[model samples]
Target: MATLLLTGASGLVGSRLLPRLVEAGHTVRALVRGDVTLPAGAAAVHGDLADPGSLRPAVKDVEAVVHLAALFRTTDEDAVWRANLDGTRNLLSAVQAYAPRARFVMTSTGNVYDADATRPARESDPCSPTQAYPASKVAAEALVRESGLTWSVLRLPFVYGEGDGHLASMPGLVSRFGLHPAHTYSVAHHRDVAQVVKMALAGTLDSRVVNVTDDAPITVLEMTALAGSEVEGSAEPLTDPWHGRMDGTLLRELGFSPEVPTVQAAARAGIL
Candidate 1:
């Protein structure tokens, strides 16, 4: 079993990914900010993503690194940039210095490509990140692409299922805040994301940037309906919700298909 170095193991994706990695016969070395109790058979190393020099202890002697750490979002801009960009830099430099040959599997977001009107964004389309999170991720993706180490970038969309709590409240906000009517964005489930990560590390997926999404796409109204709520008004589809979707063909070729491909099934699985 290769010793897998996993960052953000306590996070939403990483938390779920650890057990699967262990079950697949890979030893997991999880880096955490504090003394985080890990899943059975996982090793914990105390470390910070924004601190590169302090990462030697965490990155050493690992066969591959699955980087999943990042600040999600906030009202503060400066802090957000530093957290996202600096953390990425620190992790890359530390891995380069400590384990250059380690396969770097980065979990990036589809937001790297600006929110689009076109349904089903492909891997070949251009990127224009309007938001800070995606912008920094784009920079990080570029860094990984240039580093020359064996790496794969999975541009994840709005991941759902696996007990995602936020989905319950989004539709309730449509009338509360009067959000501009926009088509619902594409969504990937938590399990599929973890499955593709393992695939990337196992070298089954060849694309550097795989658009990790489910096969079908849904609009905001459809998503709300699936979630058992109403948006209360007409959500003019500013862009083709389908264009924001990924073909999911690449992943399907490798046997990556979510049981719940649409919002209705996802919500039902979540018991909403």
Candidate 2:
């Protein structure tokens, strides 16, 4: 079994991915800030992306690097850059220096894609991200491209399902606006997200940038219907603002069919 280095093994996606990786018999070297209980058959390695030097031994002997640690916040620019961009720069440099041959798979957002096109977004579309999160991710993508190491960038859109941050937050949004989201965007399931992450590390995916999301765009109206709240007359709040549109063609070509559809999975996860 090959050794895989997981950076954010404590996060929402990482928490889920950890068990699967261990069950698959892969030796998972999980990085954590302090003392935290690790699952069976997984090794806990202490490291911090902010401290680039700390990653030396963590990256050593690892066959692959699944870098998922990023500071994501729409309002805080300084914190976002420090966590997303700077951390990425440090980690990429360390990976290049230490495990140059290891495949570096990164979790990027579809927010980096242009929203003006109106059509479903694909991997080749020019990124015109207006928000700070996607904007930094755009820069992060550039770092990976220039790292001179084998890499795969999975651009995910509205990753949801039992997570604290997602459509579950829609009820609060509805209450804030006293209505549903006037604008709708593309989305993807969380467990499916884990599969996409694995695919990036496996290197079987032909496409470098695959849009990880649902087959077709699901509207906020449908989402709010699942929200179990009351809404007024047919007055939509705002125009359909494109946060991130995902074109999952490459995912299909790679034969990726997520077991749980985003909406249904959310309901099962108690989000709905």
Which candidate gets the maximum lDDT versus the true structure?
2
| Runs with alpha carbons beyond 4 Å of true place in candidate 1 | 116-119, 172-182, 226-228, 235-243, 253-255, 267-272
Q: How much is 188 displaced in model 1, in angstroms?
A: 1.5
Candidate 2, 1-272: lDDT as tens digits: 56889988888677878888888778999988899988998899888888998988899868888888877744788888888899899988888888889888888887787757667677888887767788888998889888888888887776666654666566676676554345566777767787887777778652376778776566666766665653443564444355445777888888788666667565766753
Instruction: Give one digit per residue, the lDDT tens place, for model 1 in 107-166.
Output: 888777646535466777788876778788888888888877788888887776666654
Where does candidate 1 have its weakest 10-residue lDDT segment?
235-244
Candidate 2 Cα errors over 4 Å, as ranges: 162-165, 173-182, 230-234, 237-242, 265-272
The local distance difference test score of each candidate is 0.75, 0.76
- Model 1 clash tally, residue pairs: 12
What TM-score, over all chains together, does every model reach?
0.88, 0.88
